[model samples]
Target: MTAEHYFSAEPATPDQRGEIAFNVAGRDYRMTVASGVFSAGRLDPGTAVLLRKGDLPDAGTAGTFLDLGCGYGPIACVLASEAPRAVVHAVDVNSRARELTALNAEALGLAGRVRVAAPGEVPDDVSFDQIWSNPPTHVGKAELRALMERWLPRLAPGGVAWLVINRHLGGDSLHAWLVERGWQVERIASQKGFRVLRVAGKTD
Candidate 1:
């Protein structure tokens, strides 16, 4: 299918390796990427903004953290690095993406801290203290909403989620949807047509 379909469970193309570099919280990260993952060639701008603006957990932070649509484990890696005591669960449907994320975690010597898995593989009893995502908005609005519906509730009470969505790609609409669903949604930051949303403390 199209290169835009990174969420496909099985990517049609062969894995072609690439690398990208970016900084988060004053630390630079260089990671291997490949076809079948999100943003194979470079750091995603929205993710960069999310990492730059979203609140990062400190070393004392514990409990599980979910990195939804983890790509090559950038978010997972950063979460593990920042909160060493926390368990980071990285979930993606793409097999190649999961493979690369696991590889990247091992390469970065974070394998013990990061757990890469398919969405269904995550234990039902598990909940997260924090969740982070640069969601696959191109997957269509219905799919995007379903994705959020599935995972957002996995956040523990008082837990927070950081999401980055392109403004033109229904960012505002998604914010409204989350609010309507009773999540306290805040537009924490914006850059390069992307909206960084901070979700926490549900309220009707």
Candidate 2:
């Protein structure tokens, strides 16, 4: 198998199924996973940090949320459960990831609330009330920046995004870059060498 890269549009690793369990917001979840998807073996550390550090939506939260680069739908499932009135779009480029996400959502009884779609399949006109991602940082600076540029602008007015990145992997530089672009970026928390950023819509 080619050296695995989660950002690869088509991962070459032979699919091998497994399961992972994580607790968040007082709930425990056991989700299915397989090779070729991001963190197929377990919930990734950056994602774990993001979920732990960022503000999860309240029970009364409404409107649509975007789980960008969702792997096996952990974030999406959590969001759906926390905000039952809201719709969640779980977007990923990897087909295996999408399939696994769908399966996990169904297993969690959240299939109706979580919509799994390929990145390009998200409706063009839908804006998100919140966006969450432990983005694919290994995609390189240019691609990573482009990915943010493409998605951040789609946030609804007054919306925000939560992201986590390894501190050694340009997290500080990315904070500066977003600030320069007029976004209000806050380093809400740093743990396990990961930086959790909360990004608000541009005011200027």
Candidate 3:
């Protein structure tokens, strides 16, 4: 019984469904949207920027990927579609979001590769070669930092994370924070007030 925000473990609101149509990397996508999910109205601008700016893995790339805070599985589907050899884990706190992600993955015929789950359902032994997120910055600083801490540490050695944050929403500060914590963070791109960060594990 958690609260009913988009970050809630179980949202109490009925799912009044909608759909968002967009194209990514020359491919068209029309994903399922529902009430109580993040960015149900459209593909979030930050996510759009991240997907456009980040260097997505190619078909030959093979590894485990994590789409932390995946909403309706846009990132997950894209990742799976781009790199058929890779496996994706789409984790979200919102149960409805998880449901929509699973449905969307199935719709895309990616159910065999995209594993949707609640945050706690991820296996402890699993780590990721790539982590992609447009995290919930509105979830407050403490919760946001905690979210990063829990997952960022699980990045496989030399792996990278692609993240997008609204520039006005502590984006610069979050970049600094990650630097202080020893990650090599770079502002890969910025558009529409969103900063795309390429976060890599420390090598030196």
Error of 2 at 192 (Å): 0.7
Collision count of model 2? 0
Candidate 1 structure quality by residue, lDDT tens digits, 23-102: 88988888999887788878888888998899999999988999999988899999999988999999999998999999
Local accuracy by lDDT, each model = 0.91, 0.90, 0.91
Ranking by TM-score: 2, 1, 3
TM-score of each: 0.96, 0.96, 0.96
110 Cα displacement, candidate 1 (Å): 0.8
Clashing pairs in 3: none
Cα error, candidate 3, residue 35 (Å): 0.7
lDDT of 2 by residue, 16-124 (tens): 8989999998999999988888887778899988988899997899999999999888899999989999999999998888898899999989999899999889989
Query: Residues 97-204, candidate 3, lDDT per residue (tens digit)?
Result: 999999999999999999998888999999999999999998877888899899998999889999999999989989999999888999999899999999998755
**Runs in model 3 with CA error above 4 Å?**
1-4
Extract clashing residue pairs from model 1. none
> Candidate 2 has which clashing residue pairs, if any?
none
